[model samples]
Target: MNSEQLIKSLLKQEEGDQLEFKLVVQKDSIGKIICAFLNHEGGQVLIGVSDDKKIVGISDAEKWEKELTDYLNSAIIPEAPVMVSLEQVGNKQVILVKVWAGSKQPYIFDGNIYFRRRQSTVKATSQEISNLIHNRQKNEFHWERQPALGVELEDLDLQEIQKTVDRSINESKLDENNRNPIDFLTHFGLFQNGHFTNAAVVLFAKNPALFIPQARVRVAFLEKGKTAGEFVDDKLLDGNLFKNILSAQDFFEKHLHTTRKFSEKEWERQDDYVVPMSALREGVMNALVHRDYSLPSASMSVIIYSDKIEVFNSGKSPLKAAELKKSHLSLPVNPDIAHMAFLRGYIEKIGRGTIKIMDACKTAGLKPPKWTTTETSVKLSFPLNIKLGGATDGGLVGAGDDNINIRIDGAIDGAIDGATTRTIRQLTILLAAIIKDEGKRIPDYKNITDLGSVRTLERYIEQLKDIGFIEFKGSAAQTGGYFITDKLKKIIK
Candidate 1:
């Protein structure tokens, strides 16, 4: 915010949350720095401040001001202008322009989102892209109406919209009055100027391909048919939620091997390795809901190779990929989409899609699906382990809700990934520590016991002792079992 600090930041030669500096020999490089701040972490770009931090003031400040203003407004998408200020440090002048991160992110200059990392202005890595999205999400960015051009509301499939409304009225409390799709969008805060947002278009447009040319959900048979075995089938998926899911399920079942279950009657058949309908429903629903429509890319894709099924979409995540790996992860890209899926019975409100997928695969005896995400995409892989065979006979149970074993099992699975979102749950041991001093065993939160919270508290106490995160000074009892450790303070920090 200040030239003195900006000069210091430039000298440090370190890149992080904010701050980048450049010695621009010409105006083109100025564009790069401006784009860098807009695309990644918001920062102040200081020119005339040498890369090594020596300030050399511009001889013509007015010329540089005109140069910067022209580039930021005319050359950026979701067009955001940079705020430029000039300062004199010792014998030199510095041109400082503040580029705030965009609300609709992935800010492009000449067609790509340029970002700052340490000493360079380059393409942002997937993680950096994802973080930009996380920050922008808090400032009211919606998936639709971004990069808006080439389409209108009526261009969308009205039938699809009507059916969605019908489903909402039939199953949810959306309205006795607001039963129209247009009204539904208004009710959902997705309408501007009486037209649908890009989210609406991508999720339910009759032919989203007309506007978003790359918009699709492809199902490929990779590792087969003699190529890299990759299928780039440029086909479109359309219709109501049920039909769309059914079609996607059909595509998945095509790749599966089914078996005959001989019962008392004639017979029943099942896929040898079907991706659980529940999981796929949740996954695909998430694909539809959480996708980053701001980017000019595909809406969603499901690629089934020989070893696994990879489901991908433009998912703007709330956490870094490393943080996601370290904690139990759940960040809905679109809560309204989630709510819609929940009422329609495709997904539950509990937000444990990973748990549901794992359970369905387990009861059917398949290895749990693996998850990997970058800023632009989230990919979930369900292994083909034919030896595990297709899960048959276990009816779909609530993996995300109405289940405790599911949440506990999720904690364990996530433990394999290093305990992502459940960090606070682990910190609940502090809840126990605070009570242990009062000489009372604070029993449990009987109301929300479905979290297996009581069991987790006891296990956390045991774990704290085991790893030295806590200690027991006296003999163990129902009460007065311990005091926290040095590690506890580290965790507190």
Candidate 2:
């Protein structure tokens, strides 16, 4: 609507949530009114209109606008933008002061908090002020600040702390002064009064789940849907939050379907998830940072089915589905944990998780994840992009793994990103061993790869399977061994 039309429409209405009227521009009083509007739904304070709806226009519209804008900038803490325009109504000029509801909130004007209540602008009560402070401190207070019982400084991993410090320093998220583990922890408030807070333990503890066992993640691969399915793989991931994130990624990678992006040259090929890795990573990180840790009986879980993959976490998100789907507000259940995670780079930015996930899915040419929530739990379902053997509506195609078609074009490429010298060596050895001695146990593969750690061997196997280079023969009831897939051979030639 035009300025005059808008003014006329607002004139006929009573002042309420988004409407306010003022006779003259009182700098201090107007600032408080603006603060109230910002704290609530955005509204306009119409100058030249009185409290009783009298249309006594301001003599100099420009003068009132300049004065109010100056006062707002100088008097408001965390200066917020305001719009002031002179509009003509009949023969007189009216000043329209527009304020937007702030996302970076708890706005203060002239040392006082103000809020609007149904046409009335008033000073914020003590309780209201407290609530605002608490909300802002979501990451400042909570489990992250509380000391973990029976946990000591030595129990934490100094290497992880050092890595976090180095990266955070390079990113300028943290200063270079605190380079040591203890100093870094102290500076970030991870160490409170000579005690390690629960956040410190969760981030750096050798075994974080020792204190909070339910903090671990459980991942499963199922042949059917949510209700019932033949379990292909089920494992509990335990360790620090960082470890759990890595383990969860490994678990998902092994189960999620991938499609081949064949290159013009036979050897030049790329493999990727149809749903995108970014979306899955975001979902897992959300489950870790925002899950309710108070419920000891509940644990975070990821379940894969033929049609979709569901990531479940204990406790319902305080944020409504509408809020997540719209505003992208950052209201973390464990703010302290989130704060550390942010500095450590577990999360890219605050309040952008769901939006990132949606965008990632869209970019990958897939539908966005389906969100489901209960009072006790929250679940995110990402539908598998590929229709497994022409199965569309969550129904299985047939017996045997061949029913699910994984179109792999070539053998595993050791030259792919993140392939170090040792990794390449391991891969070359494993591939040769699998080709030379088919259907051998992991011990035999380990001997050929010369990778002593079982965990490391398992990780490489998972990566190989994820890229469609190899498959395990035999079942849970019988001995199984890794073997190169036929698809890999088809492209290798």
Q: Model 2 clash pairs?
A: 138-335, 139-335, 139-336
**lDDT for every model?**
0.54, 0.69
Residue 226 of model 1: what lDDT? 25
The alpha-carbon deviation from the true structure for residue 429 of candidate 2, after best TM-score superposition, in angstroms, is 32
Give candidates' CA RMSD values in order: 19.9, 15.7
Report the C-alpha lDDT of model 2 over 274-378, residue by residue, as the tens digit.
467878888989888888776679788887776677889988787666666532334456655676677667665445578777777765556667888889889
| Model 1 agreement with the true structure over 1-493: per-residue lDDT tens digits | 2345535545565645456566663556666667886666556666775655667668777677666656555566654435565756666777766654544567777767778776578877878778777866754555544433555666766666676678656642345577766777766545656556666666566666666665556665553422454453434565434456777887766555442221223333222334566766667766666666566654677766544677887765666544432212243556445545554556532334555566667655456677787766777777643211122211111112213323322323333334422332323324332322422332532111222356665665555456555566654564454555665444433
Query: Could you tell me which 10 consecutive residues in candidate 2 have the lowest summed lDDT?
Result: 401-410
> Model 1, which residues run further than 4 Å from truth?
1-141, 145-153, 223-227, 230-244, 261-273, 319-330, 387-493
lDDT of 2 at 492: 45
RMSD of 1: 19.9
Listed per model in order, the count of residue pairs whose N, CA or C atoms clash below 3 Å is 18, 3
